[model samples]
Target: MRRGLMAWDPQEVPASALADRLARLRAELAREGVDVFVAYTNIARGGSVWWLTGFTPYWNEGLLYAPAQGEMVFATALSKRVAEWISSVMPAGEVTTTPRPSAFIGEHIARDGAKRIGILELDDFPAGHAQAILQAAPGVELVDVTEAFARARNDSDAVERLLLTKADALAQAACGAVDVSSAHARDFIAPAESVARLGGAEECFTLVAGDLRSSRAFVRTDSMGSLGETFAARVSLAYKGAWTRHVRSFAKDAGVQQSMDRAHAALMDFSLQSGETLAQAVARTFGSLGEVNNWVAEQPRGSYPLAPVANMAESAQGFTASAPFVLDVELVTDGRRWVGARMIGL
Candidate 1:
């Protein structure tokens, strides 16, 4: 469940922005000859729904039904007591609370006589929901419109970029709040989460690599004792439905700290040029600093908030120069392992 603040700030996200996004998706559905487009959203997979409707479920699951024209309908199992809150924050559609959300959506489809229904991430959609839809509208063709949705949402808009920048700033501030003098991993996690929550984050996840020398694996455990010679913390934060991650490394040794600082500087200066792959960008920026062991670029795709789009050893897929992405880099500088991550492309 989300522990932080969850309120719609019209100043941050104007209603016009949400309307524009819905219009784009509707255009895509029309092009595909789909009568309606349905997107499923749970706590884990709600990025697409959030992008289109500006509504991220704090808990439970829901289905967004967007007909070729007219306003969309959001059907959820959440209690009616919270319906007004959801409607207030969600500026794009009608909110309908039902015990059987999928069946409600299916009934709507049948009423409309929709012949071709488009579903986002159909393979991952709940089977119960699919069965309910089929039961309501038998023989209605269900088309997987994940790719079509991607085409509609592939580009990053100015409002989203601004929100990403704010989210990244929150992550950075949260990471910076960690007390380097702290003795335990839990100590580091505390300040980071506190800062993020105070900054109005919808959700905050803090991961720690207690000892970079022994391991570079970041985990969400408080069992570790004492900070090693070098430690790293990664803060993933969501603000107003926009998510971004920031990772920082800490070291007791002056030289190690300097190396980590230099690595971060290079990351801040890094940018993907025209026609350059993510690997090429990483090489250009960090090759001089150290041996680039690994790097991964992630972006919001399908229902995932941070889906991997590229890595150091492979070709990038669905990478766009205009879209924002988060990049994590791991490298060895003078035999010391250093890992850092930040938002790229603004």
Candidate 2:
């Protein structure tokens, strides 16, 4: 049903901030010879839309079409019922609602006289929708510009950092709410949900595992599982345009705790050391711990936002001192000592 307890501050990102973000994107598009930039979003990728427009679509899917020089138009599949809310944040005249969203978007593209267009998430965009845009703008050159936008979104602004700090605190609260004594996996869900909602989280994704024998992967607690002397909980919460995740575990054995201690040290050292890209740190760490599983050891340290879930195995080349990131360590050794997990933002 409904579970977010924390209400978002009614205050929205200032108009000037949004304008500056858009202006930066438009400038990037111009450098790429891209006439129009299309940003697509669904519930999962809602942060991308909010990054530029400061409005997160509640129920329906939407996108924004920003030309090199002109007003940005927001189009959605939702009707006027929710359209009003979108207009409140953006330009009312630029908001469009239609059952045939492709045709509506295509018509706008044609009107803008955009030929060299770049569509974010072009590979994932619906085939029917792509066809409609192709039909509207005959011989249009649509490029996949997701990487360009991702680059811009990599670093957080001052406003984003503030929001992320709040989100991180909310995640910590959610993790603290879990009661390992409860035994039942489902028992933790209600408390976690309550904490997140109270923290004004727009979304809460909670997973729990009571299995203690081996390191249990976090799973949605649709059905209860036994605690078996150990348990693990992972909670991810989204507030505003930022997300924070916390992972906690309880172990009855000292060996498991020791393993976790070692992993934590390595993770902290790797995360804090400056100058190494995520990929380099992973390789160096794996090389040092030759006996450890590279798959498990090298993962859990990667980029934040733009890809909220860390691609542990993937090597990230660029390293920025001020950019924010989430560092996690989930370790299992020789199938004997298993520590659940832990996450922190840096």
Candidate 3:
């Protein structure tokens, strides 16, 4: 029998813990000779900001600024009414809705008189905004410190682990809700969404796979169409500030089971392998997958649901023991069977 999903509480990290994070981050900034650190986020890439500030951007652009010595400040492009509601999470300031968000960021830098500033995800940040911020603060120097910022957030605190576990349960529940035998893939959306909501998740996503020959990587689609005789469904959800995923398949034949067993073992090895670069682990674990199917074991394929940022490193050479992450792996058999799984790494 399939094991039941784990139950999780709805609690979150407290303010005192957030304050501790702020202190540590500021200390790190001092060591780097950066007078201030600015973290930018939209709907995606909010993980670093939320990890430190306990505030996630619901909509629009979000910015969090931390000085070497002072209370951290949170700002966003949201209006006054929304800012008021957000004050409970973090006292938010208004930034005018403009293409160049650095103008407001510069205003904050000028207000703080920060001489040396560091921005996270500098490589991915817009060039125009970076130039605007530079123009706003003529005397200040800007540096890309995404690596430093990501390192600081690598270790998951106790509260963070709890939230992730809860997300895992919700994801399992959502997967269990999918009806792979249905004629229309859209039929699974409602129950999956309801299960996620009832389980206290903030967001839910569901995807269906057709026959193995035509199965594609998970993508959001609105096509309400029938699935093949053998199909798979994947469900993922976000709870509090964490994310997790679960995949399920139903087959009319035993050939799929033979392939799934092989793939699942490989995935287990991939998830449990530690103290190695992500590429090395993948090569060692799933190298045989290529023999079975056309699948290739690739490196640097990892992400965080809490902060869905773009362009994360493909190499996992620097993953620390405490840093929480997920390994998303999928495979297909030559006989036309689909299998996918995501394992949490803590």
Candidate 4:
């Protein structure tokens, strides 16, 4: 089980270096018998949309059409100059602009009207937008190719791996910052004690945020200043693109260390028992009710999910962090030495 978890690469990711993901997607599309990879409208924080088209959306929606068999193209609500700039990098066959992504998609679907069209990031699609795509071709089969895109897009491509490496290097440099800065000045580099040392964030000004999928955990600490209180967290592991980041924020208190010790132990224990790959653990915990306890919660309600923390170590380190010990807060995929816990200052 654990054999496969460490096999995955824990590559870092940058906002840039998302371009080559298309080639990988094209290959997956061919394997899966997809005709056209339709990337409609929104290019949220994920960076896949811009990778597909080289143009990021400011506010409106757009479309990306990548034929598994032929040239790639994109349509968006942008000026010709911006579109040309995007096309210059990716070498698209066509770059069409429209006020809305679904409208552009409807137009293109009307042109090809193929039997099956692949759609990525449909979660971002509004109900109104989905109807427009249906109207494009009544007989057309709209397949939910989001996972296919995720697999292809998230697979270790050359360029993306490079970006991941760059991100990792930046983090590594940050990790060493403690050596350069004095103890008093360590806050500029990172907090010396607390969770900063334990599988922590690298930057001094690190932040954590999540949306509908993970906003609860983020909001608990960020929105409500409540810490050290019990809280409940809901995380869906089945998600591929959902993201959450962590900052090693610990209030000045003794309990922080105690909570950190227990959290670390729990992380180790769960990893050992799972006897699964990163993929397997993900398949199991995703959409499942995995409980987290032992540490103080950032929320007055519950603890943050640990699926990310366990998954990342299992995904990157291969060994369990707190195997055969305690079970608390299963990380969905971000790390917090004490990121999830706010010390109940005594």
lDDT of 2 by residue, 1-346 (tens): 2234322343544666677777777777777888888766666666656777765666667767787776777888988776665677542227778776667777888988889888887877768778988897788888987667756655667777777778878887887787655757787556987888877887788987667465466778776576656566778777765676666665556676565445545654554356665546555654343343322221111122334233356444343435666644444543432332323333
lDDT of 3 by residue, 160-258 (tens): 777778787777677667654566667745677678777777666777775545765554547546666566667766666566666665564567556
Number of the candidate with higher TM-score, 2 or 3: 2
Listed in order, each prediction's TM-score against the native is 0.97, 0.81, 0.78, 0.51
Question: RMSD, each candidate, Å?
Answer: 1.1, 4.3, 5.9, 12.0
lDDT value for candidate 3? 0.61
How would you order the candidates by TM-score, starting with the best? 1, 2, 3, 4
Q: Pick the candidate with the highest TM-score.
A: 1
C-alpha lDDT of residue 308 in model 2: 29
- Candidate 3, number of clashes: 5
Instruction: Predict model 2's lDDT versus the native.
Output: 0.63
lDDT of 1 at 266: 90
Which model is ahead, 3 or 4, in terms of TM-score?
3
Model 4 per-residue lDDT at 117:
79
Q: Please identify which of the two predictions, 1 or 2, would achieve the higher TM-score against the true structure.
A: 1
Q: Which regions of candidate 1 deviate over 4 angstroms?
A: none
Off by over 4 Å in 2: 1-12, 89-93, 252-270, 277-314, 317-322, 333-346
Model 3, residue 30: C-alpha shift (Å)? 2.1
- Which sections of candidate 3 miss by over 4 Å? 1-11, 91-101, 252-318, 332-334
Ranking by lDDT: 1, 2, 3, 4
